[model samples]
Target: MRGSPPCGTAVGCMLLLLLLDALLLFAGQAAGEGIITNHVVVRLHESAHDDAHQLAVEHGFQSVRKLPFGEGPLPLLPPMSPRREANAVPRKRQRLQKDSRVMSVLEQPGFSRQKRGYRDLNEMEVNISDPLFNKQWYLVNTGQADGTPGLDLNVAEAWGLGYTGRGVTIAIMDDGIDYLHPDLASNYNADASYDFSSNDPYPFPRYTDDWFNSHGTRCAGEVSAAANNNICGVGVAYNSKVAGIRMLDQPFMTDIIEASSISHMPQVIDIYSASWGPTDDGRTVDGPRELTLQAMADGVNKGRGGKGSIYVWASGDGGSYDDCNCDGYASSMWTISINSAINDGRTALYDESCSSTLASTFSNGRKRNPEAGVATTDLYGNCTLRHSGTSAAAPEAAGVFALALEANPDLTWRDMQHLSVLTSKRNQLHDEVHQWRRNGVGLEFNHLFGYGVLDAGGMVKMSHEWKTVPERFHCVAGSIQDNHKIQSGGRLVLTIDTDACQGKDNFVRYLEHVQAVVTVNASRRGDLNINMTSPMGTKSILLSRRPRDDDAKVGFDKWPFMTTHTWGEDPRGTWVMEVGFQGPEAQRGVLKEWTLMLHGTQSAPYIDQVVRDYQSKLAMSKKEELEEELDEAVERSLKSLLSKNN
Candidate 1:
């Protein structure tokens, strides 16, 4: 009914009307949301540069900035009052759409970023009154003390989620604790504490001139120092209860003391943290005595109302020259051996490397800086930042375990180990001497770092929904009685092919731990190195060369060198063992006996699900790669077409 106004042809008039309609629609949508910004994006024809300035001025817009892409979208600001800006977009769009120099016009939409509903340790709101809390870099590392940022235990997120290790008790089995200290007084569990050294109920530390008896107190503070009391740094599990067993203050450590200390209050105590072990001199090979071994077996079998009491042992501070497997406590199946990592996520100089270490925590390391040491409560109601060594690492792990216990108290000792293997993070941890390797089922592990650093937040969250693992069983896979000789520079290799005791009551389907008991003697004990390869192709260095050991006469006697490297792997087929020497000169050795022991569950449905999930992830990864390649190919094709047309 209406005649064409400016354009002569009806098609041209229709195109103009359609463009104005599209621009009006865009402006309407922006105004409907009340998102009236001062700037607008525009696109101009290649030949319109000279007239762009004049055209922009006529539409109440001034050119401001050019986007990154060449001849791409340009930003223009409307020289108008904010009150008038709301109605300016539609008018400017109409005028710009009708101009010959302009190709298109669009109103800029308002956008704002927001924090995600889920939070990590770094993002959570934590209010603590302790003055030294910020200096505890291992708990909440924010690039303080010249350390790497975000390399911490991730405990804040767990605390925000209301898991503070409440209703759980961690016993410090060391010298003794200063329970009277303000920071530790409120959380001390006296009913479960005893001084085996004095054979009395008061487990207070025996004071001396040197204050050397502060080990137990410092370790206790790492686990359960009271929070918000304006004292020292807050503990990892600040709401948990701490008990001190004063046994290491004696003149000599006896089997009875060791047994009684390990078995004390097993029903009430959720975790027993032992920071002391054998001499760790790289020469001595010692372990729990007969009575202590019996007590440990009882603790795991009947402790915690049959859920099993958690025993956390420090992997020795024997340096690279010593292997922690020699300290039988760290390598035992009943204990969780924790190693140490520095503030920079590197292995500490004094950290002992072994296959038995389940996980790691922070320690003072070899750094000479005073702030680099672990900050905790000291003796005589004081505070210190000089606590160091694997002793500092074990208590941190015990605290993390306590957090998991508070989240789910039904977790067993073995369940805790499983959680450690599953939830621990490899976060920037590196070892120059040993490389990280994946196990048969793709679990990453290092001889020094074990599975990885303990992750408190991940462990606590997973523990909330964790189901108990299947009943554990043991199988004597194979036994080799024939004696073999090892030449100076050569190696002794033995192979045992078996079905892992199939069709028996003690059959093992999925492996948890493997022990290779060997009776061998060498001319130079320090040069002996032993390795075992599982049927699934995972090779575990059961025993590494300890350079400081000069004991040539008493070479290992029926020593059960254990390894957790074969965890979650199938135990079928043939297993291989290699024994050799590494030294300046060739050393002779003899292999008297070799016995393979397998411990695991007969059926683990969760492991099966894990394998399936891993496969699905692999498939999804491959699909994503293919899609990315196709996208790149299409982009290249489109660019080529545009170039040809130009």
Candidate 2:
């Protein structure tokens, strides 16, 4: 009788009982599976001004605070006294619901904050036993180490699809890898590894007090560190075989050493990951010498039983001032240059902006948190979280390439680059300096991010059904031999008009990579900036001003400054190159010669189809946007009409 609703008639009693039942149902739902607090959020009607306080007082609430949220809900807090019971918040919510002034009441359920883990259930299927697996944010960003959620290589999804680089082999061309390390020993390919420094079969890193020679080992771990072994951490392709090519440990880097290292066991190795380059001091302009160039050419032509060997190079860590085009290795059209992004989707501080960079991967950012850097195996069976820079970025890309190779082994090196351009994602990747722009074929690219970050899952998926690209051919489009003087504070603009060798044996219809090979001398080389504009109106900054370069005597000589910005664009029109000076003190320069190099296939049917698909998608997106605008306008008009009628 005490709990029964008080009413004058049976119908009134039934209505009261229904209202009580509704309140109890809401209370039960709000209290389900959550910690109950002694507070209730109450939303007052628009006409009930200052009634929230009165209602709280009547409901025995000790204090009320306006919630800075939608509709200005007020949270009523009960006093912490012996009279308070566990159901105080729910009882207050029920009593407030009975007030005509109150529009709605809800018990404020308490929820604890938690770090984001695996976003997808499939991510947990790969049982990684390594202790530092959680710290490998680049592999699977779970919002760990202050990284953004879903900003990663997406390797887990690829692994979930049963591609783990089982048949692929990657070679780490660095100082030397500790092949004897516990995490790498099982995956080490002895037949493919050799020490160009020591000229021995064993490619073990030399002993060092500061672990300076551990660079190759760390890079190797990034590609094929053993998984489920409780070692350092999992690799991007944990089942891939890794070979160490010790070439950077010697006192001097020779053409033979670099050549041998690059071409080492090419038939056995699927991908070659090179992180070292010319000194990133923003002044040095260097690349593969004669023999090394030949070796790279041979590898691409004859490697993988003529399928072509994949070459992955680090773009550089010369920061904003230094352009990666200054480094010939990264700017090389034969190599797939990779840049680095931080965990927060920002361009890394040490990243070099270059148009030739093919893609991007994650590296350690400016954050000094304990788990901020890459987790990989170090020397003497140790693990490290200090691997940073574009040096660390290249190996991650190589590992992703290994995954793709395992998915489809017949893919050629050029095919790998094609897949990279088609499959890499622009997932939250942004550069504060350079904005993303679409090419003629509707592919987006950035100087800092290239074609965007390498997507392991996407690449693997695309590789499984990919067809080998058409035969690649190079055509020297145009050449200018006249000396053009660039006065102090003045710029020199040159234009080249050609048909891109139409009807020739080596004709290029659809562009792949463009190079502006120039021989120039300047009073201050660092002050010079170079840019190239495609026929399709896409501009690529071939070289940025390098402040640290003080080499006034020796300027660029036959330097091949390359760009991938004009990929898939028609090359049968005029091309523009702008050579300008930007520095505190004006400097004089002269462009003695410039040659335009175009490398691409004569015909690519896929590119045309890609453009059509993009156009269709763009049309659909515009249509949807117009429909949304119309719907919004109609709703606004209806709201106005209803208000006038009321």
| Candidate 1 root-mean-square deviation in Å | 10.0
TM-score of 2: 0.77
Q: Per-model C-alpha lDDT, please?
A: 0.86, 0.86
Tell me the tens digit of each residue's lDDT in model 1 across 208-236. Answer: 99998999999999999888999999999
- Candidate 1: list runs displaced more than 4 Å: 1-124, 608-646
The residue-by-residue lDDT of candidate 2 on 58-166, one tens digit each, is 7787777876776555555554443356777666677778889988877766777755533742346667778999889898887888888789999988999998999
TM-score of 1: 0.81
Best by TM-score: 1
**lDDT at 514, model 1:** 93
Q: Give residue 429's error in model 1 in angstroms.
A: 1.1
TM-scores of all candidate predictions against the true structure:
0.81, 0.77
lDDT value, residue 401 of candidate 2: 94
Angstrom error at residue 453, model 1: 0.8
Clashes of each: 0, 0
